[model samples]
Target: MPISGFPEWLPPQRMIEQFVLDKIRSTFELYGFAPLETRAVEPVETLLSKGETSKEIYLLRRLQEESATSDDQLGLHFDLTVPFARFVVENNGKLQFPFRRYQIQKVWRGERPQEGRYREFLQADIDVVNRDTLPFHFDTEMPLVIGDVFRSLPIPQAIIQVNNRKVCEGFYRGLGLPDTAQVLRTVDKLDKIGPDKVAAALVETAGATDAQAAACLKLAEISASDGSFVDRVRALGVTDPLLDEGLSELLQVVETAAEHAPGLVVAELKIARGLDYYTGTVYETQLRGYERFGSVCSGGRYETLASVGNTRFPGVGISIGVSRLLGILFGQNALTVSRSVPTCVVVAVPSEDKRSGCDRIATALRRRGIPTEVAPTAAKFGKQIQFADRRGIPYVWFPGSPDTVKDIRSGEQVEASAADWTPPAADLQPVVSAG
Candidate 1:
């Protein structure tokens, strides 16, 4: 039996995964983001400092090694952001300012297996960081880059719900809430538990009064496709300088997205990303009808998290939950590959004497970039054709007078030459298509 949360895909499914990842990487590179990768294990204290996700971090150890060594203190990184922050700090002198990089890697979590949550999942993340200050324009560019990626992939349409942490922090402060972070965490549960339960938790857990909880619920309910969210928050009758700053920034985000990637972004007031690291714009992405599976991609802005020697590195980033997206897509049969094997044609060996000829044919086809396989045995023509059919190899080559090839699917045979024959472009590689 397979382990519950650790997914292992079949050959065809792995091909689909590669196709999606390639699209994401190309899109990131098109936007001038350099590729990067960090180590899987990080210091225990480094992982714990992220504030959230501490409980879900997986500690690393050797099965045969005895406990009590310093090595036991290291843990597998739960997300890409923490290790990246440490990377920036350690390589501060080498990296150029306004660094932009894209990372695609696997992350481990000790959380329970659920629809979208997993113990081992792959994340494709892109981030932009700069010394002291990161321009807000990068915030706008992030979604645009992701929009292109999602559009390029063969999956359901993704809706990117955006919110500003400043909006939540400022509004909480305006409501006289002492612990804005705690309240934001509680409010982040609004989706799992309804508004009423969230309000009750705010009062009982976060020390909010009934009136404050009600006001918080109202604010969470405010969402808009344009700048209307700004006016709606103002109508809430709460006034604070931080609130003004947040509203203005959020409005710019919505307006800029509308001008460029229309209908892709919306101002969602309740996207309190639960992580304490985000201090400005936060993002969560969901497939249109798969909201129940949770956000497949999420990230945000961390203004003061990457700082060393009084120089602060403010940055914004987003991570695509590659495993979660593929899990749901494969589960629902939303997509499929053309074949399980990559062989475009299988060379038939009439007898042991002609095996070398079959090998030469395969090698020639392979040299021309065609995926070809020689028959494992010098079997009968019918048996060799059956072998190719079983593996979904579309064509079978016979080295005979004029070198004939047969399309197994249609039973069509035609004279062909291995040195010059080329299959249709669609048949050159396995095709992945949405169901």
Candidate 2:
């Protein structure tokens, strides 16, 4: 029986996925970000610290163990950020300050699956953490990096929506709401459930009056591609010191993005990244035409999210929802690779007696950086060609004095040397093409 949410791809699909990952990794490294990975399991308490995600965490237990009691219980990490926090705290002694690292790994979430949501998924994350104070420039840098990743890919354009927790919290306080956390949580669901329902929840669950709920919804509805959102927010008639700080930070982020990567960012007040730790700017990404599918990449600024004793580490980061992106792209047939397998050439044997000769030809081709495989059996020449055709192998080499290879698609056989012959650059490896 097939598991529902755990996706396993076939060869071609997996190849396309690897291709996307390579682009993301190279972009991160190009910007001087080092790579780091943490263990899969974290203490349950550590995972639960970020209250919003506790319900989605998958707990760990051994099947053979009878007793559930233990001093410490571990659970599969639902997201990379928590494990990253634990990693930074545990390795604080040896690491340098203002550490920048990129991690690409699988994270398990026990949430219900939908179009772009999955239980088991891969996330590509990049973060910059400082020992005490993190420079505000890192917040602007996060969207720039993500913009490069999306542009380098063969997918639709990704527009990053930016907001700040301080902005939301400060606004809530201005509305005379004592519990900003609950209001933020309810506002985060504005996209999942419409504004009317969110407004009701704000009044009922977050203890907001009808006027307060209406004000909150109005703030959430404001979004713009430039600094215009700052004025729009000011027009809302809410005032607080924290709100001013958040507005300034958000304006800087949007303006910096406009100068560095135009049309790649926007100030969206509704992007209240449900996680409680986000203190400054928050992010949510939406594809050009697939706005309803939700964020394919998102993260935020967490000041003091990772701390030990009196030492606090402030960081800014973002994550690419790898599996979710691929799922949407694959479902819509938006992308595809040129070939299924990596094999570019298949050597054919005339008869059973010549199998050894075909093997030799394949080996020589492989030495020249060509992907070649020999026919398993000395079947008919046509049958051998069919085998290559079935596997999307482009070329079929026939061993002989001259040693020529045929382009199966064109059926054009030409004399070539194994040492120097090369396929058209596009044919060498599977090229991911956007439809």
Candidate 3:
């Protein structure tokens, strides 16, 4: 009776997840991003302030509380960005300017369960915020850091597709469409609903003419690995100052990515990010051969998401869908760990009286930075060895005369000291890799 959207991993799979998280965390830290965490729950209105994700937000209510008129209603956060915005505003006076932080936490959503869509999942986010203004270079830096993380992992390559909200909005306004938000929300559905439905939605919902819809679709279709996307958009015969600004900013991002992580990023004009808070560059990532699964990582820039009266914090960020990524890799059976458990060596108990001695030896090994465990029972040597083998423990230590350790797999025994002897580096910890 497992829940459909909330997934649990086995020991080995959990190890794999931890390994991926470590890689992502180390990469974020390498780029000088500090770590941060916000509360899981926020006022329901704060959650709904960023986007039209009201249907996806899980509201909180006490079962014993009968009154529905409570003013302090809260909901589980659907994404890291909104809570992060609230955090920046609340902590404005205590923090320094140009705050760079990385947050890895579980977020709950109420979306219907399906492949790659989880009601509860882990997200790793890195954002850089500054008072009043944020530099455009921060947008370029986001994808580079993400590219490095993917490169360091054993998973398939990820291509980050980028688009600026300004480009879409400006283009729509240039086309006589007034409601840019509705147009963006419709264009964001281009991948899921196809171009025709998106076109119809643009006309029916966003008040776009057939020609404007076709032009919008054409703009959406423009994608390039390099700066060629600029000319493509220009060729559409649409021009606006804000669109020009977005084009210049987006080109810089693409060109920078081309210089550092070539072919790892592309300019995809249709990446409308849907969220009303995203006022500038937006990003979506796709793993090679797993495009149908949707974005495994995404985020964008916001100029007004974090505001407290006259003060404002503008920021740019990207979030990695940690659970979604691991789920897909685990489903494909593409990841594996050296052992199901972290125990590298198991000390055999010669007898019930000698169990205390085995524990002492285990403690000595553990002090030497080795993951050691004492055998559960004082059984025959063969039976004790089997116990170690069953759990994939590489070594079985015998705490007897001379104190020898046996490599269970190789059946090789050697006299060793608990204080001085060390396992090979590779065997010291569970190694995670692609199968």
- For 11-62, candidate 1 gives per-residue lDDT tens digits of 9999999999999999999999999999999988878888746678887877
- Clashes in candidate 2: how many? 0
Whole-model Cα lDDT of every candidate shown, in order: 0.90, 0.91, 0.91
Q: lDDT score of model 1?
A: 0.90
What range of 10 consecutive residues in model 1 has the weakest lDDT sum?
A: 64-73
Candidate 1 TM-score versus the reference: 0.97
* Residue-level lDDT tens digits of model 2 in 340-391: 8999998888888888878888888899888888888888889999999988
RMSD of each: 1.5, 1.3, 1.2
Q: State the lDDT at 292 in candidate 3.
A: 87
Clashes of each: 0, 0, 0
Task: Provide the lDDT at 207 for model 1.
Answer: 89
lDDT of 2: 0.91
Better by TM-score, candidate 2 or 1: 2
Cα RMSD, model 2: 1.3
Error of 2 at 54 (Å): 4.1
lDDT over C-alpha atoms for residue 371 of model 2: 88
